[model samples]
Target chain A: MPIITIRLAKGRSVEQKRDLARAITNTVVEKLDVNPEWVTVLFDEFDRENWATAGELHSDKYGKGFGKIGSQEYPK
Target chain B: MPIITIRLAKGRSVEQKRDLARAITNTVVEKLDVNPEWVTVLFDEFDRENWATAGELHSDKYGKGFGKIGSQEYPK
Candidate 1:
């Protein structure tokens, strides 16, 4: 089984998760030659307060609402 | 940099996370010879509805309240 873990900032809609799961399953199936049923896509949603880069928390460095729409750190 | 990701069922307390992170960071630092600051521990907490095994969702297979406590699938 192939488990794909995506770590991102929280606040994504269920619709986005659905899309990502389906697309990730398809990609894994094609790339790895595995069955779609064997592929699992797990989302790890993080609060900005818990995520950091270069010893600086995202909450303090990027401010709020950056992950929802995407920014330099989280490209669309 | 070493990034360790833990995939587990949801409902864990922040105290547990703090303990785990500290212990894991120490282990990684000693084993990999990396700085504690270079080791990143991420928790991927998944609801039963979003996690599945053997083509069955955990919500349907294990029912509710299994993940909160130690179960066959999740050991304490």
Candidate 2:
């Protein structure tokens, strides 16, 4: 069994997150020969203010977007 | 903006987690002179089976602890 934990700012859509998880899980499951049930994935999402990039907080420093990912669906 | 991403297994108390975040935030704030509001902290909780240490998943490979961190307090 393997567990994958990923932390990224909340901006990507449900499709993106789900696809990312699926791709990651599938890669590890096949490579490590682990059972599907053993593969657990968690995505930690944070607001721009809570997350930072480069040298500033994503909110104050990078207002590239706002309130972007509040209604994203989680992929199973 | 600078984003710091950390990945760790979920077996810490709310106090512990809050304390950890506070310490981290205080460190960055003092050292970097950044505003407290700019410091956003997030904790992603996962089951033992969803985490891994050494060469095994946190669950099957290590049951040394279980249901350990669920009802702790989350400090502000």
Candidate 3:
């Protein structure tokens, strides 16, 4: 059994989480052909200070936000 | 490097967490022969509602408490 653990900045509502869990379960069941009941989606919420990228803490870089919109090091 | 993620009911103090991290890191270093810095120990705290065992929610079964001290399903 595959356990999918999602680590993200905590802000989503319960409805959003329910939708996410259902969608993820559906995707996994379709792709892996596993039973819906067997799929476990665990959400690990993290503070910006706990997450670091490019040797800089997200709290220091983003100042408490979920998306990586403006703090792009290289232009697209 | 191996990443160890521990899922548990959240109630431990900061000092307990610090000691746990250090002890785990040391154990990983000794067992796996990896660098201490390379071993990552992430604590994923969960509410009793989110964790289920034997098709029953922990919140409903145990109220609000940590440890399996009294919960003896089978005698040792």
Candidate 4:
């Protein structure tokens, strides 16, 4: 089983997850030549207080509502 | 950085997570010889509806309140 775990900040909508799951499953199936049913995608959503970088918490560095767009680690 | 992700059924207590993080961090540090700060332990909690095995959803396979005591994938 190809278990793909994506670590992302919390607050993503269900639509985002649905789209991501489909896209990622398709990519994995095409690239690895595996069955789509064999692929599993798990989203690990983290709170700002729990996430840190360079010993600084994301809440302090990025303020609030950072996850809706992206994190400091993955600015978009 | 060594990021360790644990995919488990939801409903685990914070105490369980705290214990697991510390234990896993120590193990990673000892085995990989990495600093504790460089290791990240992320717990991915999935609802039964979102998790599946053998083409069957966990919610359907195990009924309700299945996550409180591990899952069919991990009998413990």
Q: Per-residue lDDT tens digits of candidate 1, residues B1-76?
A: 9999898777667898999999999999999998888899999778765665433455655776555433534334
Error of 2 at A44 (Å): 0.7
What local lDDT does model 2 show for residue B6? 48
lDDT of 3 by residue, A1-76 (tens): 6577777775555555566666777888889987766766666788779988999997787875565644333212
Alpha carbon deviation, residue B7, candidate 4 (Å): 3.2
- Candidate 4 similarity to native, TM-score: 0.53
Query: Which candidate leads the pack in DockQ?
Result: 1
Q: Write the per-residue lDDT of candidate 4 for residues A1-76, one digit (tens) a residue.
A: 7887677776665555666667877888899988877977766677888899999998887766655433334333
- 2 or 3, greater by lDDT: 3
Residue-level lDDT of model 1, residues A1-76, one tens digit each, is 8987677887665555666666777777898898877877666678889999999998887776544433434333
| Model 4 DockQ class | incorrect
Q: Write the per-residue lDDT of candidate 3 for residues B1-76, one digit (tens) a residue.
A: 8899888776666787899999999999999998888999988788654544432345555766666733432212
Clashing pairs in 1: none
Chain B TM-score for each model?
A: 0.80, 0.61, 0.83, 0.82
RMSD of candidates 1 onward, in order: 7.9, 10.1, 8.9, 8.3
Error of 4 at A25 (Å): 0.6
Q: Would you list the clashing residue pairs of candidate 4?
A: none
For model 4, the stretches where C-alpha displacement exceeds 4 angstroms are A67-76, B1-6, B11-44, B48-76
Q: Compare candidates 3 and 4 on lDDT and give the better one.
A: 4
Taking all chains together, each candidate's TM-score versus the true structure is 0.53, 0.44, 0.53, 0.53
Compute the DockQ of candidate 4: 0.10
Docking class of 3: incorrect
